[model samples]
Target: MAVFLTLVLGSLAARATLADTWPAAIACGLALMFTLTGIAHFVPGMRRDMIAIVPPPLPAPALLVTVTGVLELMGAVGVVYPPTRADAAGCLFVLMLAMFPANIYAARMPDPPASMTANLGLRSAEEAVYLAAAIVVAVRGGQ
Candidate 1:
């Protein structure tokens, strides 16, 4: 829900305040979404939830979370800069793919996080939308 809301509201705001193009709006939305999610990595409770979602086999979940968070922040910045928008969107697309397994793992757990408790199908659909948005931003954003 957070992702959807962030993307929709951010895009709308961007459309109103920034460029009128859909690509520009999506780029802004993606940046805002990544910024929020990246910041969550440093928040105690959200950090715990993120770490918990990492598959058990991954060593040093905390470190991994921090690294991904930094990457997300970097992507956010890169996405908004015209010169780097495509590359950043491509990286974010890959990042989302790479991180999906953890989401699946979290959803399958007997007691999933409140955020992850949404049905797996719903989560997958949301991820698909996010990926599509990234692709749109990559292909047409900042043009």
Candidate 2:
């Protein structure tokens, strides 16, 4: 199932024109990001990086990181599930929206990371990707 979904979406990403390509790129990006992050959950440096990216008000950074990792994994899995791709896309959309504040916070804070500005732009691009994926899912009657 995973292989088939990846192939179909991957092909779409590679061959589709701009209109069709955006959503496929978004889906591929979301899938790859989730799969990688899911693996990174167990890495010490990545765990810390995740913590830093999340906002200050959030307590127990480790726990939040774990939860986020789990959600990403689930969403990635759902994206490959023919019965649940849309639901997964919706979940990802909400997750992206929920995390936007943290990205903005990181971008605007004084003494932010050297990459913070770029990270913010990347995060916005990611959000746009999700929105594009959502539109694709809707148009195709995903799930």
Candidate 3:
């Protein structure tokens, strides 16, 4: 819900202040969304929730969270840069795919963290929306 709202509101703000084109607005939205989420990785509560969601099989969950957070931050920067927008969007799409298993793991856990407890179906739908938005930014944002 936060991601969707950020994208929509950010797009509107971008349209007003950044560019009038949908591609540009969407790119700005993606960048804003990523920036917010990326920062959440370092916040104590959110970081704990993020780490808790990582599949147990993946060693160094904390490190993985940190690394992915950094990647998200970098992607946020890249997505708004004209030269790197499409490439960044593509990478973010792949990143979303890569991170989904953790969401599944969290959903299946008997007692998931409160922050990560969205049901599998809802989480999947959210992921689909995010992926679709990323695709839109990737395919047309370069313009």
Candidate 4:
């Protein structure tokens, strides 16, 4: 939210072209979020929780999470480049979908904290919003 607002405000302040501002802002906001969450993969407790949530089918859970983190950061970089923005958004859209099983698995776990259970719902909504943003960015990137 902050990233989106900042992008919108910055675009307005700079008097950016209408066609570019809106879509660029959406892509940039998601980029910021992806970067932050990718960084979160390194924090101990968060990292443990992240590793815990991986669905069993994917091999090398820890490595996978690390790789995703790297990809998120790379996507963040790609999103800022007009030429690669659509491709980045598409990859991220798929990334979000790929991560859904972890959210579902976490939601089903009998964690003692109620907040933990609810977090999955919140994440699901967030992922949906991001996915939508990605779609918008992809479409607008070609314009």
Candidate 4 residues 20-110, lDDT tens each? 4677767667666777778877777777778887877789989988988888888878887889999998898898888788878888777
Off by over 4 Å in 3: none
Ten contiguous residues minimizing lDDT sum, candidate 2: 17-26
lDDT of 4: 0.73
Q: What C-alpha lDDT, on a 0 to 100 scale, does residue 116 get in candidate 2?
A: 40
So what's the TM-score on candidate 4?
A: 0.80
- Taking every candidate in turn, the Cα RMSD to the unseen true structure, in Å, is 1.1, 6.0, 1.1, 3.8
Candidate with best lDDT: 3
- Runs of candidate 2 with Cα error greater than 4 angstroms are 1-29, 113-122, 138-143
TM-scores, all models, native as reference: 0.95, 0.70, 0.94, 0.80
Residue 4 in candidate 1, Cα distance off native in Å = 1.3
How many pairs in model 3 have backbone atoms within 3 A of each other, for residues 3 or more apart or on separate chains, i.e. clashes? Answer: 0
The Cα local distance difference test for each model comes to 0.90, 0.64, 0.91, 0.73
Clashing pairs in 1: none
Better of 1 and 2 by TM-score: 1
lDDT of 1: 0.90
lDDT of 2: 0.64
lDDT of 3 by residue, 1-143 (tens): 78778988998899999677888888899899999999999999999999999999999999999999999999999999999999999999999999999999998899988877469998898788889878988999887
